[model samples]
Target chain A: MVRYKAVIAYDGTHFNGFQKQPNGRTVQQEVEKTLQKMNNGEPVTIFGSGRTDAGVHALGQVIHFDYPQERPLERMRFALDTQTPEDIAVSSVEIAADDFHARYHVVEKTYHFKVQIEKPRSPFRRFYASYFPYPLDLNLIRQALPDLLGTHDFTSFCATGGAIEDKVRTIYQADLVVNEAGTELTFIFRGNGFLYKMIRILVGTLLKIGNGRIPADSIPEILAAKDRNLAGPTAHPEGLYLAEVKYK
Target chain B: MVRYKAVIAYDGTHFNGFQKQPNGRTVQQEVEKTLQKMNNGEPVTIFGSGRTDAGVHALGQVIHFDYPQERPLERMRFALDTQTPEDIAVSSVEIAADDFHARYHVVEKTYHFKVQIEKPRSPFRRFYASYFPYPLDLNLIRQALPDLLGTHDFTSFCATGGAIEDKVRTIYQADLVVNEAGTELTFIFRGNGFLYKMIRILVGTLLKIGNGRIPADSIPEILAAKDRNLAGPTAHPEGLYLAEVKYK
Candidate 1:
């Protein structure tokens, strides 16, 4: 069997997310189906780095698959293109070790959340960004980032169905950057792993800080609470994207 | 009456171009409806620099409108946030002289046509850009630009439309720029006025030049032929955008 690793990019608007589903269309199923057709009607299984919720997007998603062929890599790329839609693309492909499972080999991941504060809508940036009419306090959100760093319990920042065995995760970085244009705000996070709805909840709490509903230093207290109810509402999934993944 | 000149921007994916239509939802109709609502049911006509075809986008489309009430321009900019959809926006508003006309007093107009040349789908950019799977010869397309400059009969380039009294138009600048990343190709055209489908025809013939199907010098001969049948196919409308309209 020939093992291949591919870097993918997708607009998640039409997808139910990355994972395979029974009824709804998914990025994984579409790729696997395309592979099956290329292999003359043989179903194939492909492994992805992680699961992105519905409506989320990805710029550098990594994946791995095994196929019983000794063909050149270029032909495989062209074959996949012939089978997939215009919204999903295989940005890169290469030969990989047999043990290179996309999920197990991941070392680092990054996520970005965007908020457009201006009243006028941006014509070119509508799909990839989220619009918020209310004004936000940037200073307060920036102050909370330092406390959220380091290994700590993030239970308060998780939504429902967060059944991870460990709630403690190390956040290498969490920073709030006011866009140079001054009309947008971006929250960037780098971590070992993320819990269910953790990033969205973190964004919601920061928004509250911007709204003056929650104190900037209250993040530590919320983490100590270990109660999801104490955190603010979850932000929308559209503005979130899997920017990159790193492996050792 | 307060004369306001606004620089508008819109993602034309959901809009039927820049003009008002009796049947379909148009960018002009939507903006007009919003303005009427804000003016307490007052009817106002907006004059755009030019009419963009259906499915075409715009970044710096200049327009002018009249209102009897004297209010801060910022209020009108903010009011559109609640009145219009996320795809359209009034980027800026300013006071202009009574004699200033968006269409009649134009100095220069810049239009850009964007084409995506990658194999995989770019989901986020699917609606805003045109996708072409085949590779293009950029140098050959560039070689054909010199013949397109200066005044010439443009009957072969334009579509059959309302009485075209003047068939000669001067093209101050015409060039095809390949993005630094080598991922996108944009064709920019600057002139006083354009006939129906002129840009699309120019693109079609240039594409033929790139494919070696026609020589670069064929453009002047095609102009001399004064027959539309000698030209290549007209390009799709989705790839075109009215980038800017300048007036001094």
Candidate 2:
């Protein structure tokens, strides 16, 4: 068997997400179906680096799978791309190392959460950004960003109902980029890994701190408390994007 | 009665068109509905600077109406914004001078047509831009642009079935902007006024010239022909936008 790797972009607005669920179509299921067709009716399974929730987009999502036969990588890419839906584009395909695993070998990953502040909702950004018409105190948000860096237990930021036992994760970088107009806020985060819904919850909590609902110094208490109730609400998935996944 | 002027924006994906007709909802119909509600069931008629075809967006569309009673301008703007659907927004509203007219005494109107070349479809821009998967020779397009300057009979560019006798129109600044990535093209046109689907037809003809389907120098002949049959196919309305309107 030969291992193949592929890079993908998808609009997640109408997708059930990257996982194969019983309810409806998903990014994973679509790719698998394409691969199965290419393999002449044989089944194919793909492993994604991680799963983004419904309505969360991905610009540089990475995945890998095994094929029983080998051919030119470009041909496979073209064949797969032609069959995928218009909302999904498989950008690049390549042969992978014999033991390469998409999820296990990742060294860094980045996610971007976009917030449109005080701007009228744009037809151009409806599915791409989350509109927050309320006032945002950027100064307050800046003051609370540093506490999220470095290795720490992120239980408070994870989904409240998930069964994952380990909650410790390392965040390498977390920063904000405000557009020149000051009407858009982008939360950029790079980390070793993230828990389920961790970035969204973290952004939500930080927004609360900026909005004065929570104190600037309260993040540590929330993290230390290790209680899901201590964190702010999860932000809308529409604004979240799986930007990049790095491996070497 | 107090006359009012307002700047409006809308995503035209699902709208029938900008003009009110006997059947279907239009930008005009929606605005009139909102105005009637505000006027306590009294109907209000508005004059638009011009009409945009179905699936054509607007960023600075202007309209004027009259109210039986006077109230704070800000209150009206807020009320219209809050009551309108998410796809439409009344950006600004104010009292107009007694003689102010939306369709007359206009100094400038700028329309922009966007074409995405060799870029993946974006869910956000699905309704806002047209996609063309072909190679374009920019040099040929630049060579033909000068013919569109100054006042000339634009009968060849207007829709064939329209009965407007005077086809002469003056085009001011017309240019092209390609983003740094070179994956998209924007055609900007500012003129005194536009005939029905004039911009779309011009873009279509220009694209044909650039792609070698038509000769660059043939533009003057096409203009002189003053016949609709001399022009190329009309471009898709999804790519056109009423970018701005100015009156002084």
Candidate 3:
């Protein structure tokens, strides 16, 4: 068998999420179906970089699977495209080392969340951005990024309870950028790893800081508390995008 | 009664067209549905700048309609937003002079057609651009524009038969621009008027010229012949966009 790695981009508006479920279409399910068609009725299980919540998008998601036979990259891509729906586009495909794993070798990941502050927002962007009517103070949020940039227990930022007891994760960057139009604000996070809904919760907390619901200085206190209730509500899923996955 | 003019934008991927008909969901149908709801079930007809074909997007389509009452622009815009689908956006709305007519106004209109030469195209842009695999000679297209730009009897460029016998129109500009990545080519046409399928046919002919199917000098002679068969075929509608409509 030959192992292959692929970079995929998907419009997640209609998808339940990236993982397979008993009901509803998922990105993983679609890819598996394509693989099954190419593998003569044998369904090949594929491994993804990570899970993305429902309504989230991705531009450079990575995945891997083993195939029974080795083929040229172009022919494999053609077979994949012929079966995959238009909502999901496989951006790149290549053969991988037998030991290469899509999830284990990841050294960094980046997620971007877009907030649209424009009033009576464009309908065309309804599925891609979160609409927030109130004006936000950019400087306040900028001032708070340092507190969330280092390694810390992200329990307050993750969904309350899971089997995993450790909520510690290292964040290398927390950046906020406003597009040229000044109508949209993007929050970017790059980290070694992220917990369930962690980035969304951080975004929510930062939005509160920008709107004066909480001051920038309150971030350290929230981080110290390590309680989910201390942070703001999780931001909407539509605005989130898994931008990149890096591995050495 | 108050006359209002609005600038509209829509992703025409799911729309039948701009004109209202007995069947199918058209942009006119959706706008009229909103107006009907606002006007106490008294359906108000709107005059559009022109009809955009099915699967053709518009970023700055203009329309005018009469309403029973004069209210703040904000309220009207809000009401429209509440009823329109996510794929359509009423970007701007304001009161217009009673004498102003969207269709009869004398001004320029700009249409843009995008051709993507990139392989492994993104799924997010599935309906926004047409994918052309062949290498196009941009200089050849640029060399042919001077022959087609300016006042001319454009009978050969338009669809064969129409109600109006006068096929004369003046083109202010026929510009070809390539995106920074060089993967996409955009044909921009600004003119006082365009006949049915005129811009699409022009793009089709230009694509032929760029690909060596026809020589640059053939344009003037084709325009003079007044024969539709002599010109290139009409390009696909998906790549066409009603970029803007202007009136002073």
| Clashing residue pairs, backbone N/CA/C < 3 A, model 2 | none
Give each model's whole-structure lDDT. 0.84, 0.88, 0.89
Per residue, candidate 1 scores C-alpha lDDT tens digits across B94-177 of 899998999999988888887777656566667776776665677888888989899999988878765877988889989888
- lDDT of candidate 3 over B1-248, digit per residue (tens): 89999988898889999999887899999999889988999999999999998999998899999999999997888788668887777878999999999999949999999888776676766688877767688889999998878899999999876787899999999999998878788999999999999998999899889989989778999998999998988988988999899997
Q: After superposing candidate 2 on the true structure, give the runs of residues whose Cα lies further than 4 Å from its correct spot.
A: A36-43, A67-71, B22-25, B122-124
CA error at residue B199 for candidate 1, angstroms: 2.6
* Candidate 2 per-residue C-alpha lDDT over A106-144 given as tens digits, one digit per residue, 9 for 90 to 100: 989999999878545665566778877766788888898
- Of models 1 and 2, which has the larger DockQ? 1
* Model 2 lDDT tens row, B1-248: 99999999888888888999988779999989989999999999989998888899998899999999888878888898778777788888999898999999688999999988864455445567787777799889888888898898999999977878899999998888886778778999999988999999999999998899999899789989988888988999999989899999
Error of 2 at B142 (Å): 3.2
Between candidates 1 and 2, the lDDT winner: 2
The alpha-carbon deviation from the true structure for residue A68 of candidate 2, after best TM-score superposition, in angstroms, is: 4.7
Error of 1 at B15 (Å): 2.3
lDDT of 1 at B34: 86
Sorted into a CAPRI-style docking class, model 3 comes out as medium
User: Pick by lDDT: which candidate is best?
Assistant: 3
Which ten residues in a row are the worst by lDDT in model 1 chain B? B116-125
Q: When superposed on Cα atoms, how far off is each prediction in RMSD?
A: 3.7, 2.4, 2.1
lDDT of 2: 0.88
